[model samples]
Every structure is written in C-alpha cells, then in structure tokens.
Target: MPGRRARRRPVGDALAGTGRFTCGVPEAVGVKRPSLDAVRGFDRAVYVVAVGQLINVFGSGLVYPFATVHFHLQVGIALAVVGLGLGARSVTTAAGTAVGGYLADSVGRKPVMVSSMALSAVALASFAFVPALAAAVPPGVAAAAGVSRVGVAFVGVCVASGFVAGLYTPASSAMTADLTDAEARDRGYALLKFTNNVGFGAGFVAGGVLYSLASVSVFLLDGATSAVVAVVLLLYVPRSDVGGDEEADADVDSSAESGASLARWWAAATQPRVLALAAINLGIAVMYAQMQTTVPIVAKEGLGLTAAQLGTLYVLNPLTIVLLQIPLVDAVAVWRRTRGLALSAAFWAVSMVVAWAADVGVGPVAVGVALVGGHLVFRTVGEILHSPLASSLMSSLGTDAERGTQLSVLEMAKRVGIGLGSFFGGLFFDYGLSTAWWGVLVVVCLGVAAALLLFERSVTPRENGAFGDATES
Candidate 1:
C-alpha cells in the first residue's frame, strides 16, 4: 500500500477513512467502530486548567456562598445590608469583566489570569484577617467602632473578590480558546463546565461542615486554594502568545482577520445574531435567578420543608452535571447548535412550570419529589445543553483577535441578567411567590426560547466559520 494519499488530510479525517479497527479489532470481524482518540485528544493546557478550576471552585464553594450567611449570622449584620453588599459586588464584577477582556487581548491571557488569581487570594485573606484585627483593637476603640469596622472591611473584601473573579474568568475562558482548536472546543468546554460543577457541588456541601467548625476557616481555605491555583497556572501552563500571534492566526484561517481596530470591536458588538443570542441568554439567566430567590422560600415556607430538603434540591443541578456532562456532550455532539439551545430553553420553561406546581403543593410527597427530582432533571438537562454549546458558539462567531472582546460582551449580558433577575425576582415575590415564578419567569423562558429558535434559523451556513455549526438539521 502507498504510504501517502494523493491529498493531505487532518489526522482525524485520515483515521476515519482508514476504519482499520472495531473496538480494538480489525473491521473484518463484522463490526465497525470509530476511534475514540479523535474526540479525546486536546491540548495539555485544557487538563491543567480543568484541575485549577476544580481547586478554585471547590475552595470557593467552601466559603463564598456562606459569606452572606456569615455576615448575617456571625457578624450581626442585617440581611438587607448583606444584600446591598452582594449587589454591589455584582456591579464591580461587571466592570472587572470589561477591563479583563480588553487586557487579555491587549496584553496576554497568562498575565491577567495570574494577577487576577493572586489578587483574589489577597481579597479572601482580607476577609479572613479583618475579624481578627477587629478583635484585637483597644477596648475603647473597639467599643466605639463596634461591629461596623469588621462589616465595612468584609464588604470591601467581598467587592474586591468579585472584581478579581471578573478579571480571572474572561482570561481563563480566552485561554481555553487559545489552547484548543475549533474541533476540540466543544468537548474542552464541556469538560471545563463539568469540573466547575463538580467542584462547586462538593464545595457547597462541605462548606456546611466548615461553617459549623469556624466561619473564618472558610475564607482562609478559599484564599489558600486561589493562591495554589495561581501558582499552578504560572508554573505549569505554557505561556500563551498574545492574541494576534502568527501561529494563532494559522489556527483560525485568518483570511477574515484584520489589524487591531476599534471598528472590528464595534462590528462584533453590533452583530445582530450575536446580540440576539446574548439577549436570549440574559433572559434565561433571569429565569434561573428564581432558584436563588423565590424557589427556596416557597419550598421552605409554603411546603413546610426543612432547610436540608431545600439544600438537596439545590445540589441536584450540579450533581446531575458532574455525573452526566460528558455523556450528554457526546449524545448531542451531532445536533445543530440552535436546536440544542431551543430544546434547552424549552426545558427551562418546563422546569419553571414544575417548580410553580410544586410551590402550590399538589401533594406533600409528590410535590417534594417533583421539586427535588423533576426540577433537577429538567433544569440540569438545560444546563448541560446550554453551557458548552453557548461557549462553542461564542468561539465560533468570534474572529481570532476579537474573541476576548466578544466573550466580554457575553459576560456583560450575564451580569445584567443577574442584576435584573435579582431585582425583579425580589419585587415580584412581594406580590406572591406563585406570581413571581409562573407569571414572570415561565413567560420569560418561553419568549427567550422562541427568539432563540428564530435566530437559529437565521444562522447562515457561511456564518458557521471555522467551527462548523453542530445544530441538528
């Protein structure tokens, strides 16, 4: 046989054409099988980042969620004041995301990432150290300041941490894009999302135990992990070239690439389909916010369920992702991106209806089971479909040079979603929890789904770019 074909092809294409094996045997054995390596191969940075994310997310789970609780319970701050502090944190995050994305493109992904993580550790340390400092103040000074000093310091640190996280994410996300080619982007993101959820679920569960032991320990542990992750990125992950390097352009077929210009950024910002997708994502996020707001209150107060039960309901979403993400990614790998997103939005809508019914209480046992089991199953499916697919879409739509800026726009939309979701969810809850969940949220999901499907149809074949559309025909 000839050693070479008439034309060159990618290794994956060559392997697919060969069909030399069936589950480790020759295909003449009466079965044909595809090589798994084609799907499994990825840049080393992907795995390293995945591990770093696991550490950072787990450490975050151990403390971040409980920060508000700590302020309210341990520090004697009012719930309203704690809410204001958190709200301010969200605003700072949005600002940081804008700055980070610009810097990731202008400078380099690694520098921004390492600096952000290091700063995050410092912020967490501030949280850990302030209480101790407050305790040591002279009695006269301590009496004069009371808990106000500690509260002020804690809120300031929380805001700083949020900003640092904003800086870390776009760089990290852009770094993922830098490492993997278009072929591996979906699987790479799926793996990243899976690691994040696993770490988060475990962290939230373990955080309870840590909180019981000592609240201060939570912040200290979170800070330590952030520091470790920063070191790992600095030492292990190979230095990323600045976004416009010659090699990076080769990866994207940079025919469409142009020199750095504000016009390119403006073009990406004004792309109709991209903006539509971002808006749809924002709506979905607003619907999701109810889980943090109206859902838990109704589950506990309306249904007479314990805090443990509500916590279980919350855990199921991440648990499902951790267990099923890879399998689900493989399952939908052939589907068109738009169809998957439409199906996901449908699932989100359905889950909201289930939550609404559960809130009204069809039956104690049945409602509890539906709220825990049904909602988790449906909502997790939406999450599995949406998260990786959206990341891949963003990767596809962007030019190599403008990728960070494009992603920053998407992140900004998410922040808007969170702010709007929290504000509206709170206001509507005053009218009635049922009105809040079913009337406001369920409707938003349906509208977003419809709009997403419309955009799906409008996605021209040419728009598929180097990362071809995977949406079902």
Candidate 2:
C-alpha cells in the first residue's frame, strides 16, 4: 500500500489542559491549505467524542454534588451510612477501573466500554430506590447506621460504575488515538477535558435543582440519560478503535489454581509504563480532587468566596482551556517537551503555594483573590504544559494494539488517587485545614519531582504531543 495517504500539515495547538495537531480539518471540509482553522478539522471529531463524554461526565457530576444531601436530608440516612457509601464507592471505583483497564487491554475496548455504560445504568437506576429504603429506617436505628444503609447503596452504584469505568475509559482513550495522529492527541484529550468541565458545570446546576426538589430522583433521571448515551455509543462508537478480541491467545498465569483470582488480570495491568503513568496521574488526581473538598474549603473559609464566586472558579479554569490550550500546545510543540513538563510542575507549585498561603493565614480577601486568579493562570498554564505532552507520550509508548489499555491504566491510576486523596484530604480539611494544606503541599511538591523525571535527553517528542513516549499510533 502506498505509504499512508499523504496527510495535511498538522494544525498547531491549544486545548482543555491539552492540545493537538489540526491537519485534516480543512481538507475534510473542502477548504484549501492552512489558514488557522478554528477547531475545524480533526477538531470536529474531538468535539463529537466530547459530546458523548459530556453526557457521561455530567451524570457523574450531577450525582457527586447531591448524593450526600439525597441520603441525609431527603432520605434520612444516618451519618455512618454516608461515610460507608462514600468510602465504599471510592474503593469500588478504584477496583473497577483497574479491572476495567485489564479488560480493555486484554479483551477489547468496545466490549469494556459497552459493558461499563450498561452497568452504570443498572447501578444508577438502583440508587433511585434509596429514598424508599430510607423511609423504612427504624425510629431508633443508629442515625449513622441508617446512613450506612444509604452508604451501602451508594457503594453498590460505585461498584457497578467500576464496571462502567472499566468499559468506558479504555475505549474512550483509544478512540482519541484512533481519530487523530500523535500530533492531535493533546487537542483530542483536551477536548475530552473540556467536555467533562462543561458537563460538570451543567450537572452542578442541574443537581442543585434536583436536590432542592428531591435528591433521589436525580439518580433516576441521571440513570435514564446515561442509558441513552450508552445505546448511542454502542450504535456509533467503532469497536476496532478500542481493541480487537485477542485475549484467547494470550497467556493466563492462573494463580492458586483459584476460580476467581486476578492473576491474569494483574499481569496485564502491570505492563511497562502503566505504573509510572499511574504515579504521575496519582499526583494529578490529588490536586484535581480537592475541588470538591479541600480546594473549595480553601476557597470559602480561607478566601471568603460565596457560592456564586465559587462558581466563577470553574469558569476560569475551563474557559481558559477552551480559549488557550490549543495555541499553547502549538507553541510548546516548538520547544523541548520536557521544558513544558517542568513549567507545568512550576504552575502546580505556584497554585498550591498561593492557595496554601491564603488558607493558612493570609488576609482573607487577598488570599481569596490571589488563590482564584493564581489558580486560573497556573492551571491554564499547567494544562498547556502537561496535557499535550503527557497524552502524546502515552500514545507513543503503548503498543498500537494496546493503546486503549494504556489510556485505561492512566485513568485507573487517577481514580485510585482520587479515592485515597478524597478520604485523606476530606479528613484533614474537616478535622483541620492547616494539616490538610500540608498534605496538599507534599503532593504538589511530588508533582514537581515527577516532572523532573521526564527530563533526560532520552525522551523524544512524538508526532503527537501527549504524556508518555509511546510509539506513534
């Protein structure tokens, strides 16, 4: 076959905490050579995928903001029930993502993706019944225990969502690779983040509405919408992009001669770069997760932000990405990739330092303004620095056949970090803000160190700008 069809010059970058090449947009649209098309070419495909992700993430965001309120206020769950539900869901989600990554790598992206969404639908649907169960709580039940029952249900949904994540994430990442070359990976992933951000915003607003009216029904509504998304994806998302069914031929290190062991699964998930990717992602998760707890605490108690002002924080982060990530990616593409990574680390360090200072004792207004503004600049800068390079790196490193699996692993690591960080950070923030801020310091500092590891001339920039140095797809 003639060397892959002569392609167009890649579009220079910017995206949601990511960026990518924009070559095919003009040609695909019957336009002539490069004229700085605005998210036109391959960007179109990136946005399409965003639509699906938007739906999925919106559902997630909707549930997150209100689950507690639903269980306690409307359903009358005890405090212990709330804790159990949160903890159980976190663990279950982590487990699901890990297993799901293996499934994506070993089985096929489509199967996992399809399965995950269906499971999420089932799990989310089940949550609708929580109100009914809570209504039956005995008068003398441990308030916390009644809450625990609610927690158990949440845990159940989380476990099922694990299956959803296992199925959806791998396929989703692989699809990023499928639709574009290495050059476009950053933009593709950035688009993914943008979709998520927008979804989250929409969800937050919708959730406030749902919960103020009736919390449990939000789950029911979210579940129904997600089921619709799954069907559409099943109908449209290409299976080959996720992976082919080749696991039957792969070796299975059956352990303890046990029926339910994960020996084979672990073997697959531990593939090279998976752990390194996870470590870096773990740091990101820690930083990212604080939005719900730690970051907001710093925002409110430290900075004196009202709910409306707090909402502005979200606007700054995503809006910047929407406007700047692609251009930033294009610019970084000209410099050393590691330099971008380093810059990203610095941005994180600054953002945290700013927030920490405010939280610890900086004047409330000054800290608040600095924290929000600093966060906007730093996060935007960080996204430009890390998004394209990291994603492209993963694209470069993973085997063509297993690219989706690699993406799944990266996502899995993030979930793991989020779970652990949420609990730890929550306790610190709730029990003591100063101590919690310390934890943030340690994590952000480590993020800087992780960036240094990416140095060393051995690392080469791929045709695509992403995280790992995987072979081009």
lDDT of each: 0.67, 0.58
Q: Candidate 1 on 132-251: residue-level lDDT in tens? A: 655554566535645365555555665787788788777788878777766556667888988988887887677667767676887888888899999999998766664533344354
TM-score of each model, paired residue for residue? 0.78, 0.74
lDDT for residue 467 in candidate 2, whole number 0-100 = 31
Across 322-396, the per-residue lDDT of candidate 2 in tens digits comes to 556655655555344456666676676676666666566666586567666676567567765575566666666
Instruction: Give the Å shift of residue 103 in candidate 2.
Output: 3.1
Identify the runs in model 1 with alpha carbons over 4 angstroms from their true place: 1-39, 63-84, 125-158, 244-267, 296-313, 430-434, 462-473
Q: Which ten residues in a row have the lowest lDDT in candidate 2?
A: 26-35
Give me candidate 2's TM-score against the actual structure: 0.74
lDDT score of residue 236 within candidate 2:
72
lDDT of 1 at 328: 72
Looking at model 1, residue 171 earns an lDDT score of: 79
How many collisions per candidate?
7, 44
